[model samples]
Target chain A: MGIGPVAAQLEALLFVAAEPLPLPRLSAAVGLPERQVRTALVELAAHLEAGGHGIALSEIAGGFQLLTRPEHAAVVAALQAPRSAPLSKAALETLAIVAFRQPVTRATIEELRGVQSEGALATLVDRGLVAEAGRADSPGRPFLYATTRQFLEHCGLRSLEELASLANLPPAVTQVQPLPGWRTPARGAAGPEAATPDA
Target chain B: MGSDDRGGGVPEKGACQAPEPGLESVWSGLDAGTLAPDDVRVEALVGQQREVAADLEDATAAVVQLSRVLEAKARALLPTPVAPEAEGGEPGAEPDADDADLAERVAAYQAFAEAAALLRSYEESRALRFGRPQPESKTRRPAPSPAGAVSLEDLLTALSQVWERARPRTRDVTRERLTVGQVVARLRTRLSRLGSIEFEELFPSDADRFEVVVTFLAVLELVRLGEARAQQPHPFQALRLAWSGPEAESR
Candidate 1:
């Protein structure tokens, strides 16, 4: 199909898609050339703007999706009851370690926490609180975790520095002397179940 | 009577010559009248000289003793580590000059190393306080684009791109259109209900009053097209938007 029809078809596809669809997947689903799909998305985005419903089609995180205008947040919140939950202790700890020790492996997290955190990590991923930022440059090249924007939102932070200040938390264990100079991780430390103080 | 006797005693022939003119004259001219008793004066001067000499000797001895005492005290009070080179040498053997110098250099280096380590740790701690790691450079390089050069359009575009990239997906299958008015209405409703929203999505652009205008229009358009939806699942929670479906009408 030409750019016009391809753009129209892609827009149609995004309009019905449940989730933000990756460009490759969208291209495959529409059975159109990738370049054409990209051009169509741009054109369709402009067309959407021209129509003036305030919504726009755009690509995010390597995917194409439709989103509401930002100014409408309060309206949406009123219509849909907020379902967000405060971060769990384990999630907080995991986020901290990831922020301060970014490009760190899961094994390192286990070492710091002194326990297996496979389940907690999964929960964080499901919540979009953390993501596989990249692979470590070690022997195994293990997947490394990092806090996502969602994590920042949960903490009510504008940047990592804001979160870092929050980390001056009391140590998980009371009796142990908190490392005199250790700053809390950028995301704050976890509780005893997920964190341990140095002996 | 004494004068003639004393004269006769000096020498019999000389005494008899009656005091020759020159000799008599010289003796008569002498200042014996003003002189103290010669014997007593001599004895007193001699005694004084001896006393001075004795005092000098005592002072010198005391000075020497004081110097010795000071040297001993200094040796005792100053820390004296065994010289590394000297420890292996015999009592009479002179230590190697090179070894002594090396030991001094090593000690100096060790002191320097300790000072450097302390400085590094101090810097690290300071960095932690400000929510930063130790800076690799003392000053940061300036950004490529000067802050003054950034226009409102640039900022809005950046913000828009970020929102486009970072927003999450919705689980529902029904598409919704969002317009600027709809979005504003949604936010106003949510705010009146005391609900919060993702702060980023709430103010996604840097365009002053225009952002509010544009985004409101955009959201209403979105609602009309059925590409997105406003959500408030709870009273205390903030309003949020989610992708409803892909069947949203084309704008």
Candidate 2:
């Protein structure tokens, strides 16, 4: 019931967890009330900060997680193997658009880039950076995509609200201009424009 | 060819008469009432018979070519008859005899298919070269769309249905009980080779919660036995399993 033991238990659970741990799961695991767990989390964060530990406790994606401090990221990368290939420029741009204008359809992303972006969109989805938020109520019921929790973790942000303002983005990304020469790889001859709304 | 070269026709029948050069004259002769309907019908039959003969000749040539290809394939499939080697040679000198046989079989089939394809393509190319004018690649106009063209939305809907059909039909299978010992042996073997692996990677993607619990128990068992060590480098990270054998300890 003490804060010290609860904090130790929270730290162990967080260390072994593959994803961020929510308050409910943490409380259930420790067999303590949610209020006690919250206090312990604060205690643990303070303890880690005071002790100058490489790992820091942070709230991310609506859950508590232990993540390596930004200062130690370089050393950690040197130790850990690369998880996967870095996202391409196109994929990153698409991710940024989704993060900002979320619940947005593929058509909107293409309009922003001025190029066909199905490939980049698919890559982001595959990497778990973006996910289907839902279908648009509009014609054809196109799938609307948004940044996922993994995206926040990847970007080292706590939530969508913490995202860098759109003003920071380059003018090319914010403006709409259809690219003439660039073409979709799979079906270049028949672009997205060729698709018509279903009757 | 001239009517004379085409051979003499029956004099009684006007259509069969060797009276003119060119098919136009023959048609004109019919239209002018110089040739009777029966004579024209007889002439048409003769023309059809000649075409049939030419087609038959081509078909026979194709049959012969196919037969030769089959014969070669049959010969290749049969095991080669090896003669006795000189006394100095070892009997089992060929270590990869089975592999070699498999490779030969694969290569033989590949070569057979390739040779047949190449022959057909070569024939087609020659016909194209002599029979018609080559198409201008750059100047070629795009083909007109067929009437009632399906939109991509329809195509995607159809594809979704096809994909739905192509999916493996899930059957209601009874859950099998996974034992801790089984997972321990499996984990130990993997750890011995990999030296270290992430805990999340221990189980398959589709592993059930029961299986995961059993596997976690097995991991604890290995740790208790000093066979493996589990550590998490950072919070929210997967537990890393490292082999704690003597060599690993020294390293």
Candidate 3:
């Protein structure tokens, strides 16, 4: 219905932010508690929607940003605003694997694709769709890659859970099954499964 | 629902359909001593195999479908191309190159000069972009100063020294690395419990070479501070430590 002063201040911040601002960051910036900031963000989103504003409040990449509505995307593009290039087929496939089986190593991705995906992996990382989650405890301690929050924004997903549900896979298929001679997905941090060396 | 491609695209006339073996026909065959029990068993096994194959195919198709959906979503989310800027000047206001005004002539000259400079910059930028990735290979060193500012050998030597100094040092930041204080605490805990422990027993089970070194240092500090005594009966043997600190005396 109506936005408060907190919501208005949040709107200005979101509008100017190049990247999404997380709740904690927003709270710190506004000098308010996170709970109050969250409430204001909700009110701001509602106000934008009700007012039929060209820019809408979007929770993307684990943060809030003011993004042009989908309907106005065409008009905004017509104004010569910068937009990221579309990913190649190979890059998309690599992204999908990273999204589905996160904290995965490059060797696993190559094994699944049956081809070297270095270029695609690099491109995904360059585009901010994927990032190094951590290193596996196995031999060589290869860096594990996972989809970033930007990945969720790109796919219009709220969370990794949303991406998982989108597949509508059977419950059994959802569980991480360790391949032969491969360590389980959980690495380090006293994980339940024992580490298996590469065969 | 009844008639679709689920029949594997067979015609509705059923001309290609296989003959069905009715239960009566089967009984007649049995009475006539024509059909064997093994044949029926074989038929059942074949059907089971077909069902299993279908299930496998379904699972495969589901996975393929999921991949396709993810790819489609990714494609849909791609940012739209921004429209190109329209060139200035009205369509009807065409300038004749043969009889141009002074203003147009100077403008044309300036434009030509600008284009040349822009082209050179574009080439230089392209070269830099391509060359950026090649330095990691270390196959080719930076080309000597074109103006012969210094000998190639001297330049290479100096640059190598600078590079060594400027290169960022990386360290393993995993939680596995132990601090000196942590090793000291662990030693104190075990010593207080057992009154005395061998040097080998001071190290934790997950101790790495670094941790082993730290643990040794901690024990040396305890002895140096007159808080513990190290007794080795023979050379190259485990050193036994007895706590004699203020905490131990109070206990």
Candidate 4:
């Protein structure tokens, strides 16, 4: 079918594309100039908003994509009740560090989490979420890790940029966490329940 | 340790003198001729026994030290235990919890990570795009290769495999005559009759890099205009190219 409007053409491309569409690529795909495409994208975002559509345009990672509004997270979650369990707390934290501060080394991640994370790092690697982006310039040439495209897809993010403006989630718990001492905090009454799954 | 003062030989069995109670087993351990040394002097024997005892004590101490080190290492490898109040605590001050159950912490952290990934997955899947649907899982069952059964990755990989193989020079030889345009025409004709052809089978066994490159570019042209499509049943498997439709006549 012929592209009716420039904005509609852009939406059609983003809708079918597996990843976010950047300006140049969108321009090439739609046979329009980059400047014109950029303006059309803005108009498209406003168009979706003004029309009160369920989906809206967002700038994430380094491209433009269409995603549902945040207000519909609950309904969407219900529709897609978690298929698998969440990753370990360590994996999640490691993922957060990799997502935000990518091209980082194990040493940097360890420093951020305040704990040795060989196992956690290994788990993330095995799961295909974290990957060795490259070797660091420092001594011994330690491997630097970064989140993979699979990670972006897994997190439901169009791009890393989309992850930036999230409001509800607390900052990744990077501060070196205090470990439970031998002296029970006089508060493990539910310790069995909470620690069982973890155990 | 000192040189023997008396004869170092043992007396005949019947003529032997009384020995210390604990030394009875030690004496019997020596063979009749195997006593190789004399037991006539007790002081030297006592020194030897003391040396053996000290060696045993040293070995036991080493083992204890090694076990302690291993325990410390095992503790260090475990996940950080939950200390909710310590969320924003000191930066580098890591606690040494003597009773930390590392396995438990790892398990807890694992659960937490799984939860995060699940939530993240849900969040991203929002406003699901309607496009080409993913291949059905039931299709994962074994099936013979058929038309329209090939995946996009397999098709691209086959093309890439040809492209990558063409990059490395097999030998020092230079003879270039074909052009991308000529090869494109030849490729279109070769694939014209056969609905599809396996990537490698299309070429002669002796086809060199140059010929392959020319042929590859032609294939790219044909596929670009939807005149032809490639198929691959599995990644890196044989690649096949087929005409897009009956209406595809040579341009």
TM-score of each: 0.28, 0.37, 0.40, 0.37
Top-scoring candidate (DockQ): 4
Candidate 3 segments exceeding 4 Å error = A170-173, A176-199, B1-251
Chain A alone, TM-score for each of the models?
0.51, 0.75, 0.77, 0.64
lDDT of each: 0.46, 0.57, 0.55, 0.55
Residue-wise C-alpha lDDT for candidate 3, range A2-36, written one tens digit per residue? 77999989988886676556677788999998889
Which candidate leads the pack in lDDT? 2
lDDT of 1 by residue, B1-251 (tens): 01222221122343453332121121222212221111122233233334533344333322332333233334435665444455766553665465455434333322222322332332233222111121333113211111122434558899999999996977967553545666666655544344334534766566567666667676556556665567877897877765443432321
Report fnat, model 1: 0.00
**How many residue pairs clash in each candidate at the backbone level?**
64, 0, 0, 18
Comparison by lDDT, 1 against 4, better one:
4
By DockQ thresholds, what CAPRI class is model 2? incorrect
Q: Return the TM-score for candidate 1, rounded to 2 decimals.
A: 0.28
lDDT of 3 by residue, B5-102 (tens): 22121123637643334322332333344654223322432343345333443334233323332332343356534444447845435443332443
Q: RMSD for each model, in Å, please?
A: 40.8, 36.0, 31.5, 28.5
Candidate 2 pairs with clashing backbones: none
Candidates, ranked, TM-score: 3, 4, 2, 1
Q: What CAPRI grade goes to candidate 3?
A: incorrect
Per-residue accuracy of model 2 over B1-251 as CA lDDT, tens digit each? 11232322225544555543223233334334454323333444334334543344333323333333333334445665564564898654544465465434433322222322332332232222111121454114222111113434557899999998896878899877679999999998888888999978988799889888998999999999999998988998888999996577665
